[model samples]
Target chain A: MDFFHVLVVLLESTIRVSVPLIFAALAGLFTERAGIFDIGLEGKMLGAAFAAGAVAAVTQSVWMGLLAAILISIALSLVHGYASITQRGNQIVSGVAINFIVAGSTVILGEAWFRQGGRTPALGEGARFQTITFPYADSIREIPILGPIYSDLLSGHFILTYVAFAMVPISWWILYRTRFGLRLRAVGENPGAVDTAGISVIWMRYRAVICCGILCGFAGAYLSLAMTAGFVKGMTAGKGYIALAALIFAKWRPFNIMLACLLFGFLDALAIRLQGNPLPLIGQVPVQLMQALPYILTVILLAGFIGKAIPPKAGGVPYVKER
Target chain B: MSTPYAKLPGWAEYGLIPLVNLAVAFLVAGLVVLLVGENPLEAAYHLINGAFGRGEYLGFTLYYATTFIFTGLAVAVAFHAGLFNIGGEGQAYVGGIGVALACLWLDQTMPWFVVFPLAILGSAFFGAAWAFLPGWLQAKRGSHIVITTIMFNFIASSLMVYLLTRVLKPLGSMSPQTRTFAEGGQLPKLDWLLAIFGLDIGTAPFNVSFLLALVAAFCVWLLIWRTKLGYEMRTMGHSPSAARYAGMSESRITVITMMISGALAGMMALNPIMGEQGRMQLDFVQGAGFVGIAVALMGRSHPAGIIPAAVLFGMLYQGGAEISFEMPSISRDMIVIIQGLVILFAGALENMFRPAIARLFAMQSRRSAVVAQTKGA
Candidate 1:
């Protein structure tokens, strides 16, 4: 392949890998910005992925699967919200329980329903997400840098890829422009003040977590339908956690969260490229080294580079009625 | 109609909580069996019988307890320091690998006694080192230990997968594992000691490791309650600012607390590595480190409490594994459901039941009081 071909391949792969993370990061942004720590995002996404894939496989309708996935995700989110919000239980412990629940339950159910032993049957073409190519992109495919980048990176991805990118702007608009956004931030920063202003702190948190659920549903759908075309055991593979890291790195800003996702996505893309193909100079960087990139980046960012990425003051501290 | 039961102190509080906790634990375990459409009584019978009915099985259960004791204590120690060390998996993996490597390298050349202690110590060092980084970051840079510890778990598991498959390939097999250790690397079995207690060591794999775990637990209790450092750790756990005001370096305590936690977790490999297996392999401890959190929680995060909690888990784990073999359709995941329920109830049910019980007793006493008042009138 020519230099252009390699670049085009690289660009497309980057977009593909980055989409789920974008959704997850944005989901995390909503929850954390509202001042709730959601380490359970991974569980939510996995549960959604399994639900979506199983529904799609059985119904042979991608739309039905997507809807089911979102509903299940929201249900699980409500579980987290109820435990951490209503009961004043420890959020971290609740999240951990949810993780264990999802991990074990999905596999158990998957094996029972499909008999494939913790994996769903593959989707037929009609049931899988079809690529939505940009019209006339072929005509501009011959053009220089911007044209190649656009066609390779931006065009021809599954519909959700566009949605994932579009979400950043939408998230920014909602977080900054809307009254709900203000209330959400206020609740996160100080629920006591929000309550004093006569708003229901509980309602604001519920809404924030609901938004998180919807976004996580899309993230899970993107993983099953768009990214892998089928669900595998533990297939989300800590991307949810990585997205969480991105959200923190971005300091809870939607746009910065997107950027963080892309950076990690690029590292992942590079890792995959390096995997099976040895470099001419370094004789193939070890797969282990490549795999460690995102974690290494996360550690560095968390340690110092992103100075004072302050969590919402009320984050993870469940708001009690009397307190 | 009446106020809640007055709070008690001394042994009454200490003795009652665990008894109540165990009763609740068993009740939930029975409910799970019922949910699965099985006979609760029979299942409980089988569960107990399967775990301890056979001498070999009983030995395995105790050996399992040895692993739980170590990891549970590790989590308990961290809890005392107000740090949740979810990186126990990583610490255990690193420690396991270290011991395996030590055993492989030192077995033939070194004396049996020297090699065994060195292997255990080497593993502990590796575990402590693994935990040190996250602790240091939390102390020095204000990074959250939760995320970092989780990331480290992924790194450790990935590295382990890679090393086992590629680097540490056994003598001739392509499968993912190292060679079994030499006899010298194995933990010494006190056959005579077991004989004195009228127990056989041959089938049990019950060795010095169990005693070591008990000693470790006792030491942990002493460290938390008796030592100055323990006092500092407790203060830091309660309030970092208070600790600082009291002349404790919060950063140093954080790092040292994690190291202690890591070292305790490191000792867990002794069960699988130096026990019957005498090898490092896949699913060696099998999420015991994570389960340790539940043990710690159930035990109320104390060294003394953790022993019973560890034994409780060891029983469930043994029972669950045995059931999976017979109930092919049920899958081993029934254990996960039971575990989740245990945790849910362990954390929530106490809060729920205490009030209801107090109300029940209050009504009975109030009725008697009304009768007395009427008679007096």
Candidate 2:
């Protein structure tokens, strides 16, 4: 392959891999921006992936699968909400518990219902999301540079990929321009201030959590329905955690989140490409190092080497009206 | 507009509440079993029988408990210092490197007794070294320990995979594991200890590590309750502001606490590498580090409580394997569900039933006061 073709292919794969991270990072943005920390994003995504895969396989309807994914993810989100928001519990512990619950339950349910050793059946073409080609893609391919960039790199992606990219601007607008977004940010920074302004901190946080659930559902559905044809056991495989790292790396901003996800996604694509290929000085790059780079970068960022990452002041602490 | 509920008695606070939480967790687990088309009572019967019916089964259960005890104590020690050390998995993973290095180096030249202590030191040193970065980051740089430790877990996993496949694996061996240990590296099984109770271990991997685990628990108890550092750790955990006012160095305590916790977590590798597997292998920690969180939560972060909690999890693990064997429909994941439920009820939603229980106690106290007043009149 020529250099241009390889670059296009790498960028295309980068977009494909980044869709889930985009959706999940945005999901975490909504939740953490409202002062509720959610480490359960991984569990929610895994649960939704299982639900989508199972429903799509059984009914052969991608729409039904999408709905089931949303419902299940929202249910898990609400459980996290109840524990952290209502019960005044430790948010981290609640998140950990939720992660464990969904991790175990999805496998148990999958095994009990499908009996495929904790996997749903492979989805048919009709049951999985189809790639959409933009208009005039075939005719435009004769042109150089811009043609392949538009047709191959930009166009011909699964619908969820477009949705994921679109969510960045929407998230930014919602979190910055809208009143709900302002209240959400306010609640996270200072719940007492939000309460004094005659807003219900509990309700605002719950709404943000619901938004998180909806976005995570898309991420999960994208995993099973768009990226792959079926749900394998542990298919999400630390993507949610990576998304969380991306969120922190982005300093919890929507545009930065998109950039962070794409950067990580690019690293992932490079890792896959460089599996056996040797570079000039480094010799063959170990795939494990590539896989571990996102985490290492995140840890370094968390250590404030690059820049400081300050979470919401009220984050992880349950609000009490009387106290 | 509202009256405060009465304080629970000591038994209810520590004992009764946890028992109720455990009962609720099991009830939910039973419901899950029923959903899977199995009789819950029969499954429970089989689970109990599987854990204790045979001497070998009991031996296996205790063997599993040995690993949990070390990890649990690791988490509990960190908990006492107000740090959540979830990187136990990673710590233990790297700890295997220390163990493998010690065994590989000294097994041929030194006696088993001499090699054992060196291996312990090696494992603790490596594990503590693994944790020191996250700890220092948390203490000095103001980073969240939870996030850093979690990141460390991924880093450790990647590092171990690379090491095992490229560096540690024997030249002729295709598998991603070290060469099997020599006789000096292997821990002797505790068949004689079982013989005192007129039982045969019968192929169980139960070994001297179990005794070491018990000794570690006792040491943890003494350290937490009797030592000056222990008092400082508890003060830090309960109220950091107060600890600061009392002239305690926050950064020093945080780093020391994490290193100690890491060392305990690192020692958990001894059970599997020295006792059971007899070599360093990929993923030998086997989610034991995460299980430490559940154990520590259930145990209320006390050494006394941690022992029983670890054994309970050990029962669940051994019995769950038996259940999966007996009833094909019910897989080992059921134990995971129970564990999640236990952590949920005991750790996060611990106050779910507290209000009702407190009200009940308040009513009883009021009734007693009224009766005493009436009799006096």
Candidate 3:
């Protein structure tokens, strides 16, 4: 392959790997920006992935599968909100609890419902997301640089991938321009201030958590329905945690979150590409090390080798008006 | 509005509340079982029987408990220092490296007594070293311990895989594990100890590691409650500024607390490596380190409390294993849900019903007072 083709392939692979991460990062961005620590994002995504796969397998409709995934994710988010928000419980513990619950329930339910080694049946066309081609994709193929860029980089992506990237701009706009976004940010930093302004801190947090759930739902669906044919056990893996790291790396900003997710995505893509290829001097980097690179980098970033990451002022502290 | 239970009579606060929470958790678990179309009572019976009915099963339960005790104590120690060391899983994983190296080196020539101590030291040293970086980062750079520790877990997993496959795997062996340790590397089973108690428990994986776990617990209690460093850790946990004001260095305490926690978590390898597996392998720590969080929370971060909590989890694990075998419909994941429910109720939603319970007590007291006044009148 030529240099340009290799570059296109790498970019395409990065985008593919990044879609789920983008969704997970977006999911975390909403919740953490609203001041809720959402370590349970992994569990929620896993649960949603299983639900989507199982539902899509049964109904043979990707849309219904997406709906089921979103509904389940939202239910989990509400549970997190109830424990951490309304109940004024320990946020980390609540998130951890949600993680365990979903991790367990999904497998149990998946086994009961599908019995295919804790996986749903392989999804056929109409049940799984189909790649969408841009208009005039054939005409654009001979257009040189722009042609390959359009066809390889932009076109032939699962519809959900486009939505994942599109949601980045949408989230940025919602977080920066909208009143709900402003209130959500304020609630996270200073819920007391929001309450004094006659707004419901509870409601604002709830909305943010709901948005998180929706994004996580898409992320999970994209994993099982688009990225793969079915939900295997622990399909979300550590993407949720990686997304949280990306959130912190980006200082919880939507645009930066997108960049952070892509960076991680690129790392994963590179790992996949370099699996068997040995380099000069350094020889072949172990696949395990490559898989672990993002985490090690996250630790470095968190250690302030990059820059200080200041969380929302009132992030883990529960808001209590009476106190 | 809530004066009735005021302090909940100390016993009720610490003792009764946890019991109530566990009861509620079990109730929820039963409900889930019912939802899954199985008779909750039947499942519970099988679960309890499978865990404790046979001597061999009891041995397995104790074997599981030994690891939980170590990890739970590790988490509890961190909790006392106001740090959440979520990297126990990672610490334990790297700890396996220390275990393998120690066993491989000493097993050929040394006796079990000498090898055992060296093995324990090796595990703790490696595990503590694994945790030292994150602890140092948290202290010096203000990095969040939870996130850093979590990231370290992924790093540790990858590192272990590389080491196991490329470096440690026995030559000409396709398995991703080292050769089984020499006899000197193995810890003797506690069958004799069981016999001393008049119990005819069959020889099982339960071994001297259980005794080591018990000793570790006692030592932790002493360290936390009796030592000056423990007092410093507790002070820092309660109020860092105050600790700083009192001439306690926050950074030092944080680092030292994490090291100690890591050491405790590392000790967990003894049971799996020396007592059972007799060799180093991948993912032996499993989720025990994570489960330790729930154990510490349920145990109120006390060693005395941690023992029973650890045992309870051990029962759950062993019972769940048996359940998966007996009831193929209920996958292994169901145990995770049960564990999750217990953690949710006992830790996160711990205070959800506290005020309501307190209110009920208050109302009863008020009614009793009124009755007393009427009788006098």
Best by TM-score: 2
Considering only chain B, report the TM-score of model 3.
0.95
Candidate 2 lDDT over residue span B57-109, tens digit each: 88899999999999999999999998999899999999888899999998878
- The TM-score of candidate 3's chain A against the true chain A comes to 0.96
The alpha-carbon RMSD values of the candidates against the true structure, listed in the order shown, are: 3.6, 1.7, 2.0
Model 2 stretches astray by more than 4 angstroms: B1-6, B375-377
- Which stretches of candidate 3 lie above 4 Å from their native place? B1-6, B367-377
Candidate 1 residue-wise lDDT, A1-323, digit = tens = 38777867876788789899999989988888887888888989998999899999999999988998899899988887877777666677777777776776777678767878788999999777999878787889878887777677777889889899999999999989999999998889999999999999998999999999999999998888777777887888888888888887887888888898988888788888878888887786778777777777777777987576777889987786662
True contacts kept of 2: 0.71
Clashes in model 1: which pairs? Answer: none
The docking category that best describes candidate 2 is high
TM-score per candidate, chains pooled: 0.90, 0.98, 0.97
Best-performing candidate as measured by DockQ: 3
Q: Higher-TM-score candidate among 2 and 3? A: 2
In the range B1-377, model 1's lDDT, one tens digit per residue, is: 12234554445345565456557756765665565466667666666876776655666677778888999888889888889898898898888877887888988777667776877798889889989999999999888898888888878877887788778877679768778777877887656665676755457676678888999999998999999999999998888778999999999999999999998898898778877687788657688888887778788878777888788777777776777676554466766655655555454333445555556656778899999999999
Which regions of candidate 1 are displaced past 4 Å? A137-150, A280-283, B1-46, B161-173, B188-206, B282-285, B347-377
Which 10 residues in a row give candidate 3 chain A its minimum summed lDDT?
A: A314-323
lDDT of 3 at B184: 86
> What DockQ results for candidate 3?
0.84
